[model samples]
Target: MTRSLIVIFTAIVLDAVGIGLIFPILPSLLKDITHAANVLPTIGAMTALYALMQFIFAPVLGALSDRLGRRPVLLISLAGAAVNYLFLAFAPNLTLLFIGRAIAGLTSANISVATAYITDISPEEKRARRFGLFNAMFGLGFIIGPVLGGVLGDHWLRLPFIAAAVLNGANLLLAVFILPESRPGSRETIDLAALNPLKPLRSVLEVKSLLPIVILFFIFSATGEAYGTCWALWGSDAFHWNGLSIGLSLGAFGVCQTFAQALLPGPAVKLLGERAAILVGVAGVSVALTVMAFAGQGWMIFAIMPVFTLGGIGVPALQSLATRQVDENSQGQFQGVLASAVSLASIVAPLGFSSLYFLFREEWPGAIWLSVVAVYALAVPLVLGLRPKAAERASTSRRRGAPENSSGDASGETADLTFRHPRA
Candidate 1:
């Protein structure tokens, strides 16, 4: 990896670490703040508040990056995160906590910008592997962050946020020193109307060829985030696990995920190809969530993680496919659309899943997992149907003398045709 890649990888890790660091402790902290019989709903609302902010602001920041540059947006986000975590660390009431989380969410479009940075440097063909690398760093950070949060939080619940603040601070400083601007030409004037998060999504969804994958992304995002919103709480409720145990379990989950994301996608794509690999991944996610719903024992949960980890293949493949749908100049906007999709998921799913978990704690503790299974399963047939069409497109491109092993980028003549293709 180049120095820039390494720094960005670290940035990815830092972002995940900040998030994971809070997961093990946030529930209990929220419980203290609300003093309610059921804290799950309140926690869900808090998460939703954050996600709502993300949904509103992600496209705004993403468009700004397209106009200004990725570096400034990233740096501003890092600084905002550092401040937000500090605010969360000291928050005395739920209102302040909510405010802090909203601020954090507003600035959290950094990931989308970072992804655009990746697109700026990588060829389209290698993007899946590159995205996998980003996920690997994400998983690694999740491992370290949650473990430390759970362990340290056993003593002081506030410690994890402080740690997160420190990490973000460090990341900010490192980025200041090493991070390079990745946006190509600066837009002289950005369209204020173009910054609406919903508009870009509407446009992307209108593209007939992009519809299936976009739907797949939306469903998967909703289900995936719903699971995340409840994972720590579910363990605490179902297994009566403590913060330490929750951290360890999540850390171990991260380990399994990291291994899969770092190692599996490349080989899987090379063998089964990207489309098939995505099918395998989505199908595997459905199976894993189904199994997780039925896991009566905690150890059974551990046993199921590797199977769950296979779902990691879906994202890189999906991302790689999306990259081919747009011109290189619009990569930032494309990634912003993706982040907006995820942010939209984060907005609704947290509240929905958390409500289900809290409501059915006695009747069905694993209710949220069932929802997850259903969503992933729903996307499966759609994507499976998506395969033949993608294959046909590839076949057509090859017949037209598009490079089979060509450096899939936007500069060449073939790329211009790709940019102008009716489906594109």
Candidate 2:
């Protein structure tokens, strides 16, 4: 298990580094081949196009992984992404560029496969911690990738693409030799309908216990759009930040998040219990977003970065709880459904957040952050309801003679939602 985790961790970091390598040069690459008048809109369309393709393809890839096993699916996905980056490196026209983005989006569904792989090996009680470490690995890559890309981009606009392909090639080679297959076979056959985006989400919705968290997941994901869509523009306009300042600020954020995700989640869940941990994360994020809304200076933003990152605990906790609910064989499908929600959020969030950012950016620069605050605030109440009533929990603890120091998720394949109590 340790070896498996180590290998997947390395693979993910390499993949993320490749992605980060390109971020620094994508705008210049686009501008070199197209007129400026259409470049921005073209970028917007490409972003939406990629998200839309992922929304359509993620579940399909998820179902395929279930049938074929994770190893082959992952290898294929990695190879495709490598080729896509290469295509982008030498593309003669915008048509090829759009195709590259679409291909990347479709193949990036390997995230679901990767998460399912972790689920297969991790001990149930420690799944959240493992997931956190997994996130941190990618965070580490994001930190390295962009800085390296910036250095390389100074030499040539297309240089990063070549580097990305090499990084991905290295990842593929590592996986081929060291990564073992996690899921071996499927119990049921996958049909054409099973691959449809709505089909997987519908199956997931049928589970009553899983439904609320799924909804919370969607809301939480949409809220992410705020940061993804607005952070660069907002930082520049609000703080008069130059590229150096923006990169440094973002690098600071990655550092804080890496530590938070790597170290904070396990103890937080062990101390607060899974349900309460989610609540704490929600509260932290909501408060941070609120503060970020009116934060006047760049220093204030840096001060709040760690506190805001605590909210990320909510994600692993939520996933851990969901994993605890389902059996091993169905892990791929459940994760696929979650991926679908994330993809849908990617589609909706960019449009809504970017539109709001553009509409009120000048007259009300804080409007976008305020909107994110509202979205995150809504998650608090929704998650609050997921906890059992205090009176009921107390009574159940007494009836069962459960220990007073009880915390962490209830130990079972099924969630003990009916009597979950951190204090118990």
Model 1: per-residue Cα lDDT over 91-185, one tens digit each: 99989988988887887767788888888878655678988888889879877877778888999988888888898898889889988887654
User: Where's the lowest-lDDT run of ten residues in candidate 1?
Assistant: 410-419
What lDDT does candidate 2 reach at residue 96? 91
**Candidate 2 residue lDDT tens string, 132-213:** 8878887899899888888888998778778878878888888898888987976666677767778766655555666776
Residue 336 CA displacement from its true place in model 2, Å: 1.0
lDDT of 2: 0.76
> TM-scores of all models?
0.85, 0.88
**How high a TM-score does candidate 1 get?**
0.85
Which residue pairs does candidate 1 place in steric collision?
Answer: none
Quote the lDDT for 395 in model 2.
Answer: 35
Alpha-carbon deviation at 269 in model 2, angstroms: 0.8
